[model samples]
Target: MTLDEFEDTPGDEAAPIDMLEDYFGARGWSCDRGGDDEIVAHVQGSWGKYELRGVWREEDRVLQFLAMPDIRVPDDKRATLYEAIGLVNEQLWLGHFELWANSGILLFRHAALLSGNDGPTLELDQAETLVEAAIDECERFYPVFQFVLWGGKSPREAIDAALIETQGEA
Candidate 1:
């Protein structure tokens, strides 16, 4: 699915990471530019802390962003966590959750391709939305992962519990 928002510009396009940095800075988020094409930002969510990374590939004109929460699945919980990821991803409209194979790190990833007549341009609003989506999805599903890893709950149970809608605060 096309998860990116774009606007047509007449001239040369700045790298996507640069645009992402500006968005993060505007939100007062702590971010570090890894290089010309990469940036990492730290954001706090209600469930946990997050590390958001943006990488721009000039060759392919693609911008990839990842949001990783401050939680890790133990080796024994890997199987269960994978099941929970599938359930969580099914409900998402924009991005999906994944557990890194090597690190067992859970994260949300989405990519936008800046290909067309417009070149590699990304609007500020699009950048902001992209970052917001990542954090928002991560926050929404944090408890599901925790349910499987720590609470010994089944994947379906975790998803059901996490997705329950409450009418008002207690």
Candidate 2:
């Protein structure tokens, strides 16, 4: 998932909030926030075991399916988890998962499939396929994709910037 493999497109017009409102309303999901440039909705799915979060920013929209990992780490092993997550994140980034602001998005989705138990043996082809799926998803909801993709800078940079910005703001 190198930048060379990603099909980076220029940003488009902002997605209208009403479209998201309609989509969520049909599903009985209620809006949690209704700011001018952002909207968040909490949706309960049929399984009733997981909570879905739909976030809409001025230029992007994302529907994330949340789940807790099955394995729990001891307090001392937290660092190991952080390292593992970082490795996965880096692999994702290399696989066309662009870091925008504080978040990351895959332009194509097979990238996710590469994250196996090993967490370090991701192949480029798998990453490419994953990115393709993400692209297709983005096409189906271009406004949301654009908003999420373009709103943030790179994730790594954003975190550093946030720390500095917050320190200054404080």
Candidate 3:
């Protein structure tokens, strides 16, 4: 389903998971509706591929989204990766990065509180924004992690190098 098709969907009729699944599918992204409340998708970012998972908690009226990059932080690099994650997180306005120590996986997680005065509702546009933000942040900071883990650069140096913005096109 494309955005146009999603737009045609009656907002009140679709659950949060359904909306998210449709949104990802519209972009020709590979995604699976794991269940009534869960959806998983793989999104290709400029840096690499990301696994995006969405879970809708009806009781809590919250929607949680996680974006995991296809990279693992080795044990030797975990300490530096921790420092790098701290530095990178300080510069973000939404969500945060976390390392699953057991699995050595790095992921960005953010949740939306859907419990409003009226009721819990997740608009399609809001879902899109959430997913977009997650991907954008992940892409923006991917190289920083790479610099720290593989390039043997200090946390500060990694942040500084990854953040350099070049003006105009080459």
Candidate 4:
């Protein structure tokens, strides 16, 4: 679900963040406070070390969800950074949808970043299809972040649109 679609209930302004924390904890995940209003959860799954960070800003009424591996890439291996980034991006997308569907919840404003220390790089951004038109924009530059604004009727549609955009770039 997108930030705007995450309804604010009565008498509970921070309910969203609390719900996320609870969800992760109930699954045997360890949660820690990252920044002032950010919660980071760590879970060791069969795939690898999963680190999910949720940043909530009450003042701005914004929330950001970030997922990546717990390990940091060494400076020397930066040459093959694309491989690492691809792994992270693929996992995040597959994991996010799986979790959301399992929990019967929607995720909006979904974006991803795939960076590489070497030359080749790719970025993917997508959102729910009903919420907005599909956007599959890419650049040859590194350090690119893909933005997917959620709140669509169907996540599949959004993903399809994004894929089309990605294909066009390629």
Candidate 5:
């Protein structure tokens, strides 16, 4: 659904996921329901595909989105990956990168505190920006991750190389 339709929804009568699914679908974005309280999508960016997972937390009155690349850090590179993620997160605005130790997964996560009397945030525009920014930042840092994981570049080198600004309208 459009943002207007979402805003018109009765806060207490329907779950956010219903509106979320429509919000994404109406934009020609793929949305997949992951169980009762989650929606998953692959957001394509210049760097690669980011798996964007939106999860609803009933107890906290919050909605969270995690955007992650398709690749995983190898067991041997986990330590370096952690350092790289720390460097990458230092410059981020909306979310931070994390390495899931048990699963060797890397993700950029952002959370939205629910508004109104019930359900998730009514600020769909902010939600869009959060998700888009997460994916964009993921793209910006992916090269550093690759350098650490397979190119044998030191954390500083990888981060510095990635940080080199290209002149253009951002």
Candidate 6:
């Protein structure tokens, strides 16, 4: 979606929520109200399924997007996953990629802090950029997780194999 399509306020709602509502809806993904001002977005990627949650913090005035692959990262691979994620997170600009030790869930999390001058206004590109980064990170590193989980490859080996130069028609 373009910047013009994201007006500051879409009706009575803030732009962050509206931008996500329209963005995910346009892709035909089920955008359900996930209670507590959060919209849960579910979509299937090339490697596996994913869940993107957009939570609008009314008090903090921030929109946080949490993206996680459907696959439950095994505990045995957590250390290796952390190693691989360290390399991956270093290259990221927007948010940090993390695996929650408590839940064994790998997540791409980002937050856009909005200004409360007139109202919480979120630019379309700003919201889109966050979501895009989340998805991009998930898609790019999915294979590494699979390698560690199913292929039984070491973290270094998996990252090395996944990061190899892949040339093909886009």
Clash pairs detected, candidate 6? none
The candidate 2 region of ten consecutive residues with least summed lDDT is: 105-114
Q: Each candidate: what lDDT? A: 0.83, 0.32, 0.89, 0.37, 0.77, 0.80
The candidate maximizing TM-score is 3
Ranked candidates, highest lDDT first = 3, 1, 6, 5, 4, 2
Which structure among the candidates has the greatest lDDT? 3
Clashing pairs in 5: 1-22, 1-23
lDDT by residue (tens digit), candidate 5, 86-136: 878788778798988889989889887776655344355666676778878
> Candidate 4 regions off by >4 Å?
1-14, 34-36, 83-170
For residues 16-66, what per-residue lDDT tens digits would candidate 2 score against the true structure? 333334434544556654464334554332222222222333222332212
lDDT of 6 by residue, 90-162 (tens): 7678888888888998888989888857878766567678888899989988888788778988878988898
lDDT of 1: 0.83
For all predicted structures, in order, the TM-scores are 0.88, 0.30, 0.92, 0.39, 0.84, 0.84
- Residue by residue across 1-170, what tens digits does model 1's lDDT show? 11222233332245588778766765778799988889999888998889999998889888999999998878888988988899888898998999998998999999888865656777766787788899889988899888888988999999899899999778
**Worst lDDT window (10 residues) for model 1?**
1-10
Error of 3 at 30 (Å): 1.9
Error of 1 at 28 (Å): 0.5
How many angstroms is residue 120 displaced in model 1 relative to the true structure, after the best TM-score fit? 0.4
lDDT of 2 at 25: 51
Q: Mark the 10 consecutive residues where model 5 has the least summed lDDT.
A: 10-19
Model 4 lDDT at residue 145 = 18
Q: After superposing candidate 1, which stretches have Cα over 4 Å from the reference?
A: 1-14, 116-118, 168-170
Winner by TM-score between candidate 5 and candidate 3: 3
